[model samples]
Target chain A: MSNIALEVRDLVKSFSLDGATINAVDQVSFQVRSGEFVALVGPSGSGKTTMLSILAALLTPTSGQVLIDGQDLARMNEKQRVKLRREKIGFTFQSNNLIPFLSARENVEFMLRLNGRLDHASRIRSDELLARLGLSDRLHNLPAQMSGGQQQRVAIARALIHNPAVVLADEPTASLDTERANQVVETFANLIHENGRAGIIVTHDLRMCQYVDRVLQMQDGKLVRTYENKKEIRELARGSIH
Target chain B: MKNFFLASYLAIKEVIRNRGRFLLVALVIALITLLVLFIAALGEGLANGNRQYVANLDAQLIVFLEKSDFSISSSRLETNTVKSVRRVDGVADAGAIYTSSTEIVSLPEPLKVSMLGAEPGRPGMPPVIAGREFRGGEAREAVMDRNVALRTDIEIGDVIQIRSTQGTEDEFFDLEVVGLVEGQSYFFQPTIFVPPATWEIIRPQSQSELTSDTPYPNIIAVKLADPLQTETMSARLVDEISNIEVANIETTINNIPGYSAQQGTVQTQGFFTLLIGILVIGGFFQIQILQKVPQIGVLKAIGSSNGVVGLSAVIQIIVVTMIGVGIGGGLTYLFSLGFPPTIPLVFNGSRSLIAVILLLVIGPLGGMVSIIYAVRIEPLKALRLG
Candidate 1:
């Protein structure tokens, strides 16, 4: 099998607004291998959200090929796409939408429950993952009872518990303070790398780029630069390369 | 099967987590159910009060005068008509029945009572429970219904005074109660049965007809040899006997004055109650779904299919409705135990069962629009990412 867990080739998504067609995602292409964490960073309206949505299989591109674990999304029907999304993809939104009624552990195990794999071992794994994220004491706490940072960490645990081929985080730390943001991102990175999952984090905060293995920057719906060197990525994380 | 379990888990957990809000809505539903069930029971009770005597008649056919439109008050049959009806091929026996209304003055309060006169050992006479049946030729003996015994101190062997208006003056005749029979209520009043000769002497009369003694009965109760062949026997009796119309027991009961109108009014009230139930339930769930659009979107994004979401909502509605109906049923039973028999509230088992089934079905039906709305919510739009 190839090392690439997610591959996107020339993806384009266009929307018709009051009769005129505009391209939200214009001919974007990238590939992330297993165990690699990539950061997609750009200004607002630079097609970062559109790119993430297309990668999440939530929005169909006008024309493109998105293959996760060697299965092409464009060739699958709606039912098949939903099944694929459940089995091969995991995403957390900007709000960290943990179901307010469920406790921290139940929120994490919901992913496995959706996939019909919530057994005793998966339950134990859910507890262990939360414990690794430093939420062992807050396992039975509801989202309303926990802090914003604690809720975001629970969201991250939920994303990784299902062991999907691709893990996507869209502004997972947007609701936290700077210190809490750095802690959440570092833990998220460690869990992704330890599980050998291809992880993608979409953020406009340049400091969050420090935890990622590579940084892909976009401008005017195009890839403007690629930062791959460890020193260069470190400099970008310090906000010196903007 | 796995999907069902998952859906149930989510639905039940949410209901438990937010029990206060759900329980309030369920209580509203329970109140609605109680209203509907009470209306149904009232309808049954009123109809039963009107037709109990006619409904309990042991005969299969009631022969009324032709052109009387099956009305007991308007129909008149001569005493010889009973013999002609008994001579018919399919009729086993026939008896003359005379009906009138009078007031019983023996009690502290004047109680209105239905007076029916029939011969002893006849099909029209109800079975005795307390005392022996009155002899056929007795002029002053009577048998009272159990409802009369319930209302006052009158019982078997008691001499009750019957007050009737005759020639612009109220005359009272004394009669001894010889027997007590159960549940012979008619025209919403307790009944007293007497021999035909005594009925002729004491029945109410208008001042204009103080001297005329018409020896005619209101109708003839005919016992059929083959009760299952009522249709054929009715046709044969109409053909054999002139100036007479033959109706089965059900048709006779339905034709009682105000019976159909009472039933229709009560049924219409029940129907409107169910309509209000639908609106209340529908409105509550619609608001609930609107408030949780974001949560639903997040669920959709996390690989929860529309099937799971829709199924979960349905399960929630059914669970809530079951709780409401269960409480309503229990409350209805407990409340029914406290009512006096004069209030006319009775719950029939099969009718109550039908009402319960209707109550259960309306829950899912009322939540259908909300279910469709939940299923159509796009994950991208719900999260406000698009």
Candidate 2:
């Protein structure tokens, strides 16, 4: 079996703005192994969001391949890509985009429903997952009735419920308080590690890097450095990195 | 099928959760349904009003004066013409029919009725619903349409006083109501069937032209030996007889004064109402889809196929529209019950059913644009992530 859960092979993404070609992601390559929780950290306009979008199969790269479990995204048609996204990849946007009309539990179960795996067992699993996320009492409440932190937790549960091979989160704690942010990041990390799924999160706050197994730092559309040492990761989490 | 159920469940759940928002759209659809159904009913009513009398005729062909434009009122056939028509080959029976407008002297106000004179038990006479057909040699007996009988409160064995004219002055004739027929109206007025002798006395005759003291009937209604041979037999009659015209029942009914014009006007109005219904439904759903773009994007981002999202939207529209149409149909039934029979509003089951089917189909047809717009909503742009 392949140990790598996700592989990005020299991915490049370009856009045209005002008749000028700008590369959003330029020849960046990385691999996330199974059961590893990594963080992609960068400043605004560092192309982190664009990179995450490509990994989630929401956007196509200009060149290069995104492989999930050794199957290349570039070689697949749109229908195949959609099926892969539904069955193997999970994502939570920065907005915690839960359907407003659905209850907290229904929002999380929606992923399984999309894959046609929702059943009584999955429904019970949904409740248990919400309970794990400290939202047992709010499962029946709509997104509008839940707080920002609570909605984010529901989104995390939704992202992991379908047992996707790769879980991609972009700024999962952007709207939470510091304590709640730390708690959410810690729980997100625990879920990823426990589920043995390759996970990646993009965040500007280096302090959130403490819960991650590795941190890939980026600048100017390139992966500049990585913090894999525990001491170095601790310093990075403390915002003491030079 | 499971995917469809999921889509349907989501659609129903959202509609239930947001009942207030959806109810507003449902109310608009209900109003449109009311207008459409009413227009359909009105069109049927106006058409029935024009054709009810002629439509019920048992004759296969109607003979008229050659230059009378095939109008029953303008056709003045002599007794010799009726005898000549009956003697033609393939002509099974020819009955003389006379029609005129007269007033029934009733309480409160006089009711206008179409006076029709036909031989007893002939094809020209309407079938009786109650009492009995005119007995042989019963000249003073009359058979009233249900509308006239019900409105005038005259029953069997009751004497009906009708104001008639002979030549110069108006006179009253007392005719006993021996029978009642259902839904017989002529020229937009309730009809009363009388025998040929009473018709002659009530019919106006000129004093200077009183020859043999006998009155000639207006139109001759011919029943062919084989109904399918109407065209050939009708041509034969017109060829054999002079100064006469022959037409089938439907063609003669179409030639009724103002009938085609009235039907065309009502039909045009009904079509316009249907068009407006399409526009209203399409516009409502388009706005609904526009407001739900981000939600749709979230669904797509979660890996829902285009079919799922589109099916959900279509299910929502059909559910809401069916409810609205049901309410509208119920309301129409309730409101129509209060209308008097004279209101000229006829609601037939088959026509209403057809109209309802058309209305139901338009719900999906009109929402197709919204479905396309929804399915085309780009996840990246809608989520504002790229």
Candidate 3:
């Protein structure tokens, strides 16, 4: 029922490596209404990932205000921020990033356990999420036992299992083959359309841009353009957008 | 919290993935702990045996007779005072002995000895290895330690000259070897025994006139029907035994100059060695925690809290250290068995237990420091690196 799941204004982040200051993200501002699926498209090293990190509450912008459902993240303390993050944000990395020692089910259930909320519903949800992701047959399989695509699905299941309001994914299909990438993109689209979650997918592959409802293109630490439709993005691919 | 548990599970997985490093650290910590413990345990076990051996000889208590606050010159108790102490209430048999240092010459070289003079009815020293026993009133007879007696001419009726100093011509005497004793000296030098009457002739009198006290002998050996009455007997000696000192053997030998003080020094050194062990563990784990920064970044980026990621490393460190130190300490105890009692190595349980606990704490405390640094590793930066 919230107006926006995530809102950022005048975000600026720079890093001083050795003695020179390099601006990684500069004055980037955006908002995601509930159930919005946004794709961040940028050239390599164009600060797309930095913008996504700031949105996920993982990175503190050197100067800016990030608000989730009207709560300002810049003002929240560490415990409050962690609580907000755990309850609100989900992340899917490009690398299948599954815990190598844990079984697929355990990886899903671990989020519930980490919350220290052991309920029948959480357990049921973990099982249901794995099955929903077509991983019911590979429930007990570790990351090594599963293929890259299977691992990516498990990672998605982990992200959504906690039922967070916002899901921030960084190149969720980078390690997958073409088919797996499409499947993962479809899942992200479903997460917004079917589950009413705000999802941000940062990717270089324009193929995934079709799954997102909106697309933002970046160039040199700035959002140079935005597109209101993913189908438009897929149909019009001349490396220029407005 | 869910994020925390998930991250923790993941960290442990990552930690174990680098088994070669973790195992090596664990093994080194355990082995070092074991080695120190082995030395310590052996020392303590042997010391316990020595203490027990000394206790069984029936020394009720001990007393110190100082030549001065600064010096430990020899002093004698008047013979008449011995007769008076014999008359005290619960009065039992009491005799005199002289303790001294002298030298013994065998095949390889001349060895220094801590000597004790025996009188009648005073329980003769126990034999563990054995040469022979001292007989009464023998003028020219002495006893050597049994351990080395077989290899030398320290046999019965063999003459061995005992000198008070390396170059001193003033104090020397030849005596027929009478007996040998076993398990006598681990902390002490190899022992030689002579008769109390012979000691009366051979003991060095102080040049200071104040020390020329009337006495039976300086050291009195007592046998009581009731050991519980030591306090009463001690009091009686103060008042009743005129011009004679009746003190126990326990306090006298142990209270010798630099004796008790040296024990404190050894214990302190042992304590710091344990601290060094702890620091080594802490240092190794600190470096390990630093190396896992990227993993922590991944967890944090996934919405894991600092508490979960930091404490996971701590728990991991504690588990590894306890396993390592436990095995090390156990092996140390086992290794101690081969050490002889005369090795001057003592394994003190209280000291070692203190060391083990101290060593154990280093892991977690060091983990805490490392965790603080680990938490500072930006999750965003970590993600970028990944």
Every model's TM-score: 0.95, 0.96, 0.72
Query: What TM-score would chain A of each candidate receive against the reference chain A?
Result: 0.97, 0.97, 0.91
Per-residue CA lDDT of candidate 1, range B170-209, in tens? 9999999998999788888889999987787788877766
> Over 4 Å off in model 3, which ranges?
A1-3, A9-29, A62-64, A144-148, A220-222, A236-242, B1-21, B42-97, B100-276, B338-348, B365-368
What local lDDT does model 2 show for residue A135? 97
lDDT of 3 at B224: 67
lDDT of 2 by residue, B198-265 (tens): 77777555666334445567788888899999878988998999999998988998899998888788
- Scored by DockQ, the top model is 2
Clashes of each: 0, 0, 24
- Give one digit per residue, the lDDT tens place, for model 3 in B15-120: 5765677778878778768766654654454444334334445456432233422112255545554455456676566555456666664346777666666564
For each candidate in the order shown, give its overall lDDT on alpha carbons.
0.89, 0.87, 0.68
Q: What residue runs in model 1 are displaced by over 4 Å at the alpha carbon?
A: B208-215
Candidate 1 TM-score, C-alpha based: 0.95
- What lDDT would candidate 1 get against the real structure? 0.89
Write the residue-wise lDDT of candidate 2 on A1-242 in tens digits: 43899999999999999999998898899999989999999999999999998898889999998999888998888778788888888888788479989999989888888888889999999999999999999989999998888988999999999999999998988888999999999999999999899999999999999999999988888899988998899999998985
A best-first ranking of the candidates according to their DockQ comes to 2, 1, 3
**Which 10-residue window of candidate 2 chain B scores lowest in summed lDDT?**
B206-215
